[model samples]
Target: MSVTDEPLLSVDGLQTSFYTEEGEVKAVNDVSYQIDRGERFAVVGESGAGKSVTSLSLMRLIDDPGRVKGGDVTFRSTSAVATLARKFPEGVATENSPGYIHVTELRSESGAVGSDPGATVRDNPTDVATSLHDGSLHIEAGHVDVLDASEDAMRELRGNEIAMIFQDPHTALNPVYTVGEQIAEAIRKHLEMDDGAAKERAIEMLERVGIPDAEERYSDYPHEFSGGMQQRAVIAIALSCDPALIVADEPTTALDVTIEAQILDLLKELSNEEDVAVQLITHDLGVVAELCDSVMVMYAGKPVERSSVEELYYEPKHPYTVGLMSSIPRIGDDRERLDTVPGTMPDLVQLPSGCSFHPRCPYAEDACLEHEPPLVDVETGEPVEDPDPAVHSAACLEYTGELQDGVDFDVQIREDAATDGGESV
Candidate 1:
């Protein structure tokens, strides 16, 4: 698992939603991004902005009523090819290694992707390995939609290949189990180590995460540890396996500034030492400024902008991003009240027809109210269904010059607090 130039993870046209008594609530709209091996990618947005949901969807942790409707989550791995080879002992005929697996695990019941008439994946050997034979997937470069894998395969993939750190360490941890026991459980289950070895490794991980007196603390229950200590334990469990990708859902939100810094620094260290990729989900742009290589801004469940962290903060192109920056307090600000977007996030179930943020955008015009703009390169502003995730892009009519009276980002900034460290936010 050495880091390579090729992308380790790529998500395309991802859409996840919840089915309610009223209707389908699009929690995560057509979001797409790709992260390279060992990269720290940040997804920033206010609460209910689908930041957490996106991560949860990637982990396939969406509970009943919430389903990942449309999307492909591809992860590069040679081991995954072996996993597929084992899963499709009879049906799949792979020419190349399964270098990438679409971890979503498309179910055989998800219609065409897995249950095709010619390639139906059935329990019996007589059945076609239809799950891996998605007409399009030849398994070259190991790119196979994981949505086609079985639950058993997905289980093996979770802690071993992909891991997650929840927002609240207390809730994520089992109250009845000791901190070390839980870590050992994960180790034993994923790594298949014996109890004695697993416990020893768990202690080693605890110490690695800066836990003091690791052996003694191994017997301490979750309630016994302080808030910061609990978070450290969570990180210990997450990193114990050295997963290829770790989706950290606001990992530092519950900690104090000092602890937050320590946790962030620890994550940075692990990213380098372990060569693990991280998808850091948080609303704090300051944290993104500190830890991430690239940033994606989400609004009302849709990606409004994405770019390198410097470009995102220093030269934001979307109006929503500008509004978010205006809300952040700067040192020389003279305004009596803090700047905030005029309106709150729209109700997901009853989202406006066109651009969801049009109501709150000062530059919004008739066109914006009628037709939502696709995310596009700010320089070209040409409408693109799926813009390059690595390039600077935004979803706004102004980018395409549709709005005659386009947004003047200057209006959102004060004279002295205009840029952050000479960057645009």
Candidate 2:
């Protein structure tokens, strides 16, 4: 497969926990997914669902008391591949055509093949071997284990390859510095450009993110701008280095509806134009419906359901997912009260015995209280130990045929509601 065909990010069996005074709290548990290049993915759930924690873990920003205990986070590094080619040009040979190279052919002066001199190719074939394809110079380098990388390595990776858009713009931006200066600092530090060049790039970023009169706003402080403007500034900084993937943790929090819509649109536009992948974390299903191609519904630190936006909205399998969809306020619905999932999120430190969501799951039975159901394919009802990131799956006993009643829900998509911009559930 071409480099573009491989997943940009692969997270497997990710387990992040916090060493709290109360006890060890499992903030993120066995969460796994993948993000393809230029793909828009969403992580949706209520507060304390581990959505933010998961993002922080991926970014290696989890502070004191919290630890990413287990799992593998593999990321494709184009810069690493480029560095390899520069360091060992003799080892890289053209394969079929111009953008294709056989990395295994790399050999040192000693005629030894590998990343290091005097090492056989068999020693580190997969870890050091790179690939080129698609006629676009898309270098598919060996995967970098983010969790295992050193602090210095992480510093190099952050903001350059992977960037983050924090939840609150006010808190994210520094009050002491001009917003333009902050963006310029990141650009200069990563791209090694002079101050004037970085400033020009920063102004370009601000304008690209739709700031009005970008050149004039270059000197404006964070407090001088409105909430929406501050958010735009934050986005500009996040996009300053032209990162390959951006982990946006609720980019539209606390904004007015119009501003939120604009921010979402800007993200979509940038992702399309820049070919950057996006991993959006939000509690709002509306945002997911508006922007994301695929959705992973997390609950109490684990994904309970995973599918495309259309499939999840139209044919939900897990009861928790059903409850979430049911709770959305439909414009044409006549019900006085919107449906709500019963009970709050379980305490992470002392999560219940079997399934973490069994207490709140409407279809929970005795089996659910005794055994946690594995995530399984919705159609085949077979346990998926290693699920394809894009496939539809859910972690509920109903899929396993253990629940006697079997979970069922109807999604009524009104024919005329589409034209009127109304919703039905």
Candidate 3:
């Protein structure tokens, strides 16, 4: 499968929650998306918007207080398509003077564009064919229902087929083990290689990731490496098995600007070279525009908007998305005060009855405070409604028919002030 082909991973109606001592907190509510092979998809939001937790949920890595309460995640293996073209020798000089030689050459000499030469390609074409015969898989490219697989099934899919790089490299890397040993361990576990082979592969991966003296550095501890080097090592571990998909959660948060740019470039290069889909989770919309093909904007545990990188940065639809775009400082913008999205994020334990963002949105209406808005299609100035499903979908009452002309923010401020015991606004 190629990047232009249909998505290999699909998620639908994902609802994740945490059973905390305080109460159950719904972290992710009704999240859905599809990630095609070799695509760089991004999940962007403020803290507590469930971006990190969503990545964890996809890998079934949630533990302790957190659990995937509901939803489905389907993963398919993709590969390069190889078409065999056979050529026979025109005149046989040897043999019985009538011998035929079959010269099998790959079609499209530019390297079999859409073929799956890797074992990580999991989209079972055989199963698909059998299902078509007996009716099992039954789902079309875009219409496939998200799969509700068991833990064991998901475990088999994770790491080998899908791998995740956490936000903090310091914490993600094992301080006690040598960087080489850890990478080798991951390779051995996922690739099923012996210790020696895994070590060799680990050194290769280290060198591929631009580590200095890869062989010697393999025995180096995590603390011995700089922030950028640690990040590269983590990426090496993530790509050890050549996973079909990689979920990177804020991989550049701790690095300096120069290091951050390098890491981003490295990730982009790896994604292209390995032909692996990447799910980049971060709060930096700038990074999203730089790295992601499509972007999902989440707020208060729900996706407020989802659109392509250009559409999101240019013609943003959701109010929240617009606020975020405006919040980014431009080079020439010189105003006394920078615009900020008013009001703090709500308490997840006890969210508002209606639109969660209504309390903070400047354009929010009275109806927004009374009823929750359903994410739906809306006709704008154009004669025809936008058919791009991924363009823009917002959970805001303003998009709906119900509109309240003017609503005072005084009530909300008073309530918040009282909640904080008359603290300064």
Candidate 4:
């Protein structure tokens, strides 16, 4: 899709929570973004930063205690609307289709029954057509929202339109079934091929992912294959349906450095070859810089900053982003102490009253504790030359002009006064 075009998937105000025995844990909170066709989007954060939850919400795969509270996920197709209209007419509707909405016309037998008489017949048609054309028709294309679709409809779209490669290949793959059988099952289910054809296709996919002796290894169990092989098998299964979008949730987490590099290369190659958009979820900044077109730095279940991978690595905006970048160990640095972000993640059940990261942020002031800062355009008001208004954003009181003139050094003063016989500054 072109730069001016609507995103293939757009998520707005997404909130997901789980009702635990202790309390409701907000896994994801009002997270939003847009993914263009064939773009590599990465969600980078520490573990439990809601990266996986976001992906699960997109697939409607959250179950049991987890539930989506509020959100709008809108998906736009790259294919022309005329083509989709041809395949499925304006008035036509399918019961099992996830994003299918029907438009009904009421024909009055008598002209006397005129409701909203001032409105022209053309106006009503236009409104209804617009709603049908753009408002409701959404199917999740990977992490993108396919709108107006029910659970059943989403199931149909899941593997066919959007596929996922989970973090753990061993658990994700069926232990009892042969590797070939599992792949063939996915192929048969999504591709609607017969048993023989599905098996053949499965073998072809294994070969495509660089699994040696594909035909021989198809019948091997999950335990029989090595970690790298299992991961490759999982990739083969995820790509079997030729989905438009793929969610790789730390696909390299379980592998060695060499294997991880190989897997990353493989994914990159597949993304280019198949023209499929990828969402890579990981905490590794190096991986984000290497593979992602755009990077979203999340903290406390919220995106603290977002920018192009290059900009984010080279010129981070938020203090949290800067801290994360600084935490990355250098190859030849001989410093006694490596820089580290202070404090642990706050309890999601009872988050801080104001900015969630304020407790850990060294630059935080009293204003940060008074109220949460809104994510906004930094350049319009500030005299400082900010690059790419849309590309960078930070949710911090320091950037929002709410910071106090002087730093609040209460903790440092207390420590100093206790250690030395000096009055607190």
Question: Mind sharing the TM-score for model 3?
Answer: 0.76
Worst 10 residues of 4 by lDDT: 135-144
Q: RMSD for each model, in Å, please?
A: 7.2, 5.8, 12.5, 10.1
**Candidate closest to the true structure, highest TM-score:** 2
Query: Which of 1 and 3 is the better model by lDDT?
Result: 1
lDDT, candidate 3, 352-377, per-residue tens: 87889988888876687788776654
True-vs-predicted CA distance for residue 248, candidate 2, Å: 0.4
Question: What is the per-residue lDDT of model 1 for residues 275-382, given as tens digits with 9 covering 90 to 100?
Answer: 888999999988888898888999999998988987777678898888887777767656688778898999899999789999998888899889888888899987
Q: What are the per-residue Cα lDDT tens digits for candidate 2 across 40-120?
A: 999999999999999999889899899999998877656544433443443333433222113323433344343532133
Task: List the candidates' TM-scores in order.
Answer: 0.85, 0.88, 0.76, 0.79
| Better by lDDT, candidate 4 or 3 | 4
Candidate 3, 217: how far from true, in Å? 0.6
Preferred candidate (lDDT higher): 2 or 4? 2
Error of 1 at 19 (Å): 1.0
